[model samples]
Target: MKKIVIVLVLIGLSVISAISLLKTGEVRPTRVSELKSQFLEKATARVDHSKFPILQIKAASPRDLTAACLSCHNKTAQEVMQSNHWNWERPEYIAGRGIVYLGKKNVLNNFCIGVDGNEGTCARCHIGFGMRSARTFSYTDSTNIDCLVCHDNTETYAKAPEKGGAPEPVLDLNYIAGRVGSPKRSNCGVCHFYGGGGNNVKHGDLEEALFEPTRDIDIHMAVDGVNLSCIDCHTTERHVISGKMYSLSSMNRNRSHCESCHGEAPHADNILNKHMLKVACQTCHIPIYAKAHATKTHWDWSTAGRLRDGKPYEINDADGNHIYLSTKGSFQWGKNLKPDYIWFNGTAGHYLLGDVIADTSRPILLNTLNGSYHDPDAKIVPVKTHNARQPYDPAHRMLIKAKLYAEEKGQGALWVDFDWHKAAEKGMQALGLPFSGEIAFIRTQMHWRINHMVSGKDQAVACTECHTRADGRLANLTDFYLPGRDRNLLVETAGISLLWISLAGVLLHGSIRIAASRRNSKRG
Candidate 1:
């Protein structure tokens, strides 16, 4: 009986230890507080949301929860209403199509194509409620704002896919509303990380692995490292968060930058610091991306219609990332991918709707990053260039947006019916644009800028990696003269000749000095 009681006490102690470990996973505990509590304590609001009488009621709809939030913070809704997250379009000066509003609404990308016809599914990412088609969706309605999606601390708040951006049915709105606070990593990542359907598919740098990254994966966001959150760098003002991917944002204004926090002279080395003049910080710091998971590098939408036995099938790679899907297409995923370096100014140009494809033979750059060595603002940056083979119209000589997802599937959705012609016609019809009856495939590329998962300073790019003659990083960039890689034969020969001449002079002078010293010693 005594032995049994001692064993039971040991089991209880073991259970408590396991629970403590579960709370603090790999995160290093601090002297004052655990890592999780450190972030929460920093985000402590003036008033406890639990004390509010209005939040106690069980809301019938998510809209009711938004109304309750607006009772006190009414101005926030108006600010979010005008922001790009709500509108998804901004007035931008595309080179040929000057000052036209361009965004996900009209811009044609290589991944999922345009979102004009598939607004219901695409609205999953939009921070709003009850967004249907482009014509029916109310842009002026401030009440459509989803305050809990961003503010909910419970992290239970999630948008149901294909439901016009409605909250999941099981989520207790009352419980979630009472725990509202500033947005956390999980809040922004729910949409951003899951873009292009799955994890790390859209942006190669961003993935689910960043949620609780190791020190080697990301020095900033690592629980053991600096322990920074997304909002720490992307500071918000009124509802507009800083930072813009050149993918959506065209204008250079309101951009978040590393230099904003870490000065231009972040490096202690003079040479490395000087490199900042022409090289962006990300080029060296984030040497490789998709560190923990594979990202979609090449997507072939032409091979999407293949089925196993009347039913669509899917195939995954060794890493469990989808390689082939009957709905999407054959995909080539890459992990620890070295980025394609490009010179980029803050400004960029994008391929808008109705733009005729001039040269269909060569792969089209869906969005062109405007820069060169000559441009003062231009800096060499690492970019993940996602290549794709997608559907386009031969007659119209343009990329066609195929109707993908519907609230109710199999109406004209490409994934449901697998009819390219019908889907193209339906998609173009919704956009009020002419579609050619003929369908063809064209090769295209989209460059996504890598700015996250920054490795430690010690793991930065070595000098020889970019400077060496063989497999040099700057091989594609030939416009400017790089001292190590770029030099004329005459200069090389002259440098060698001068070097030999200096060595001979030193040798002769030393010999003469030695002989004089011997003669002086003999005379003494």
Candidate 2:
């Protein structure tokens, strides 16, 4: 009888616990796990080029190897020929300037200016061989495609400096051609990481350190982390890569987004995921850039021509970084720095060569990053603002292009003769633009979107970092109201008044209840 009574009590207790759980809501939504990276599942080994008898022949030149690749991938070579890497030209529409052909061939940058007269040196980054001059370059040449440069598995091939994109003479063409495969990080880094003449010169986030990085530096590229390759994110179809730099491309198309891999709603909390509406993934994830090396933050071309003795000289800081040079100018380098916040909707406009500058008093925004807090499509993104004191045509109100590279001495190249007027005239004449003759130094700024050197969630920015009134990352964004940072005088007074009224009402209700309870007790 005692055992029966104990069992009945336990059943009653279980029923009460179940009822309590149901009332409190027992079901919870589970966050799905992130899918594996698609590139990680791809086959690594395919098409042994060494087995092909055509690749065994001793190649006399880089073009001979291209012919062998064409024998199998004739269709692939055609696709490559159409790519921007080969032609260095893309038809794009700008905001004010409509339907302009913007590319490295004609687009102007603060560093090195443009590639019109400097094709011999600048064409080293081009995929095809023999692009000595834009006017003289034959885009129809099929054999000009340097197949071994991108496909070289032996890592023995490289484009020689100032050789019109030809492979280095020291490379064993036959050996590299036999072992051809898809491009690795080193192949892309060879030109990209070292662009603007040295390591970490152009893009701050991309550098030599990305070859093999730790998890702290870049969670995506880290060997111990996901160990992702450039091709993984770049995701090429035929030869057209998906990602395009706004520095060259002006369109909103063909961009790589973080959502490509991680879903739009990756966070567990709804509050955190809602931030994806206005805040870009990079804004919160990439707190700093140039993780391992210092990037050039400033360049003063006004101080470039100063020479030591009769010869051009270079100066390095205690950290062995170029601080000043007779050819380039004075530079300011920064390492692991925070990026400037900006509202970007992907569309951008550039001050193309020969385009007149609107204002002379303020710094010329060489490329204007257009967006506002009101735009629904726009999101806050982090960018590296590269500032420079570049040469300008004050009379024409335009940024001037100077002849930077010279094949021989006394060719009016600024690097060789140190004559700004002669270089400007020569460069302008080559591009079919009139030179103003009056050259003046003017401050200019260019924005490079920071996408790489990403950090994981643990290293991501905290809420207080951008929520505080002072030293906030998004403090410069004053157009919209940010909670915890922004406070209005009217709202503060209304909130305080409401709080005092609620407190007085609570006290009055308590006193009335106590008085009623006392009256009831006296009547009893």
Clashes of each: 0, 0
Candidate 2, position 366, lDDT: 76
TM-score per candidate: 0.86, 0.89
Those runs of model 2 whose alpha carbons end farther than 4 Å from true positions after fitting are 1-42, 493-524
> What is each predicted model's overall lDDT from 0 to 1?
0.86, 0.86
Assess candidate 1 and give its lDDT: 0.86
Which 10 residues in a row give candidate 1 its minimum summed lDDT? Answer: 29-38
Across 1-524, the per-residue lDDT of candidate 1 in tens digits comes to 99999999999999999998997676653332443465544555877887799998778888888888889996877888878888888788766667988777778888898777787888888888988875578988777888888888887889897877888999988988888888888898888887898999989888999888898889888878667889888989998889888888787788889887677786657789899999999999998999998999999999987888888999987889898999999999999999899999988888777779999999988889989999999999999999999988889898888898765656788888877888888888887778978889999999999999897678888898888776788789999988778779898899999999999999999999999999999997
Off by over 4 Å in 1: 1-41, 493-524
Candidate 1 TM-score, true structure as reference: 0.86
The true-versus-predicted C-alpha distance at residue 492 of model 2, in Å, is 3.3
